[model samples]
Target chain A: MSQIKPKSIRQVRAQWDGLFWTTMSVFGVFYLALIIAMLVADFRFTNWSDMTSLLSDARVRFSIWLSLISCTIAAILSLWVAIPTGFLLARLGSESMTQRLGQRSPGCRRLFNWARYFIDTLLDIPIVLPPLVVGISLLVLFQTPVGRWFDQRTGDLFASLGYAGIRGITYEIPAVILAQFTVAAAFAIRTMRNTFEQIDDRPERVAITLGASHYQAFSLVALPQAWRGIVAAFTLAWARSLGEFGPILIFAGTARMKTEVLSTTVYLNFQFGNLRGAVSASLILVTLAIIVLVLTRLITLGGSSNKGVIV
Target chain B: MISVQQLLLRQGDFELSQISFEIPSNAYAILMGATGSGKTTLLESICGLRAIAGGKILMDGDEITRTPPAQRQIGYVPQDSSLFPTMKVHRQIAFGMEVRGFSQTERNQRVEELASSLEITAILDRYPRRLSGGERQRVALARALSFRPRLLCLDEPLSALDGDTRNNLTKLLKKIQQSESVTVLHITHNLEEGIQLGTDHFRLEKGQVRAVVGKDQGGKNTA
Candidate 1:
């Protein structure tokens, strides 16, 4: 004898079959309304010339290029500096310092702890300090004698390579990159150090035992294992630098077709009542940001998957 | 032969003093202890990863107490089975050879030999994360052995494996030891494993060597 299927009241609802569809539809409607409103507003006052000129304008092109190049430079420098800092913080704990401190007095440990706290507070200053303040501080420091001396010593050739006859860190690409790096690297170091800390020390120890030296162990073992986290840190720093505004404005003044990065160009366009130019530049900025985000996601995902392939 | 003498170190709240031991040429020496009994510290001191506050380690009559870990020529397989996650199994096995300046041909040959012996030939293209616990241990062991060190030290080699896997790995380790004729200093808390593989066993307690026994029932109080 064949068995007959039993019917239950509201079987679809009871089984959660329709719940997903309903949930999706609710979110879909909200998203659709937002998109429709944006489209209507965009179409009502949209000027084709503004969009076209924004892309075709030499100044706008230069601004986009400048932003990309500076942000890339800042991000690379930050990673190069941050990785070592993070490694030292994670692997070399305060135990050695604590031992030395113990020789002096118990209070020294407390002092060292306070020092760590102070550094942490210093790191937090970037997040809270307005970008304009950061830029002004940089400008003030760059104008100092010591700063000029150091710059002349290190950047004589770089100055010669530039179109303008300028010496030391002021209103230049390097200055902008340096300011962004100063803020970005500290945050990157904090992020990467936390990640490196979470990884077990056993791997590096194992590598050393397997005949790899300190550098070999770090490069081949620790760095590779922590690749995903490092990539994430680099992405964060890069994105932060790309979006940087006030610091770039004050340190690297807005010179059209030269130092006019995306943010500054947009600001200048708005100030001059060139609404179309402003909107076009804003769109370009948004498009660049979206492309970067998508690229980062893809790269990170690929890197993580590559790590997973190792076993 | 590997010999340690008068080892001493201080790390806040714990002190290691006068710890000494010897493993004769090509013999398997098992170091037995509870956690925090300074077993790992002693191993690390020999490998030169940890600085000895006072003491000396001699391998084949050459002093290596002040040597860096990379130059020590001691193959170390840690408890966590540290396989390079970015590498394929083959590359992981060959990394030590590359570091030690071995020729590419020799590295490849050594990897092939180790992989086949460990029955991991099929997993050569796989990564460390994709391997099972036992497979990981096998690859880690293979990598360590590829270096052809004077001595191989394992810190709780089988501690991470399931019972069956541990038993199987013990057999594999014994086979590798016999074939390679390599000296070994293994640390473990497992009594059965100790009895099965150890030619001579030393018990450690509270930073001191308690006793040395030739052979006996597993886990008898040495002190």
Candidate 2:
């Protein structure tokens, strides 16, 4: 028998490294291949004629328009809330807070810490909850006496403003926007918070010391630096709104040409055995998602390396 | 004159107790401390960025302990010269005046004056990210002095520079201090820096601050 030579440490290490990388690549490529397969399946199932046919349908066109309009409105509202909420959360646990709370009793400090944690967890509830559950919760909430009272007030106000056909918020066109905002705003808030955190707080502090108020410092120093993050947050919110189906299906109810967005259009077509239409709609969403992803990447890469958006 | 009396500050488990110091008007005071000695904390407390547990800060005999930072009219240049990355040098220097509702003409004039004085007029239109380290420090200094604050606080403004740049900036700092006649409290770790620029010297150790007499007086402590 020929004597076998022992493997050198370097050789063994190289072999192990190769095994590790191959295993990792297997798992990574598997997911990527699955995504590609999904796209391929979607494309193979739907032809260009399917797209043109769907576009020809007034209801489908309305769905596309609703999707664009609702997602845009949801994104704008999300940004309105996200910017302030994110800034507050980013500054909440900062060193300045420590100094501010240092003079208080330990109990007070503990209470403040608990409050911060509680608020943070509370904000994350929408992001973590099941999409269907969020819709159900909104439905239930609107059924409550307080919700009904507010809804009645808003309905009367809209009537006074000459939108005589306008009704309450549940299962209406507004419901789609509300449902999308409920979920998308949470993601936007998270993105904005991370964006603010990545930026140096020292500049804001310096601004304050230079005779700028907190609002001035934030608007002038922090807000200007956070534009890329804003873009990322807006794109994420829009993409998320575009894909939001479960909440809309439950809360908004696919009322064709009124509350039916693209997501619901896909489902409505599938329910009616229109596989071609459903697949085409899904392809449209997929294309939009790809565009959003590319845009987010470009924005992130174009940003300053030190304070790029977390998304 | 700027004075911090019996100051107490806390961050997490770290505390600086009964810290007290005073810098005379137009004095170039240097505060020397070890790393993590709460030097920045003390500076921030004085600037109203950080709250103090028990202290009264007086600037020109006015009690400003509870006063907001903006109203305190104190210019602060933090370590790393935290310039606004989005704004060009001109806007960075004009930020304070702009916020205070200065006219466009006045803002332009002030920005131009500070840029000329700081020798950063060449980079006026350039954003901070494009500037060199020394240029950043100069821009920060210019921004701080733009509003002609009565007191200027610098946190290790020269620590990040090389030997030649550090020496040059040190000389510039002295020249600016004299020309502006603004009281300054400069934080540094280099004793040579303290000796070269400081008319009043203080050292922070173990969260306590004590005055260090000048070399002419044998470097004794007035703690």
Tens-digit per-residue lDDT, A108-192, candidate 1 = 5677678777766776687778999999988888779987786675468765677345455678667778878878887788867
Go through the candidates in order and give each one's DockQ. 0.49, 0.78
What lDDT does model 2 reach? 0.89
Q: Lowest lDDT 10-mer window, candidate 2 chain A? A: A302-311
True contacts kept of 1: 0.66
Best by lDDT: 2
Chain A TM per prediction: 0.75, 0.92
What's the true lDDT of residue B198 in model 1? 89
Interface RMSD of each: 3.3, 1.3
Chain B alone: TM-score in each candidate? Answer: 0.95, 0.96
- Give me the runs in candidate 2 sitting further than 4 Å from their true place: A1-7, A306-310, B216-219
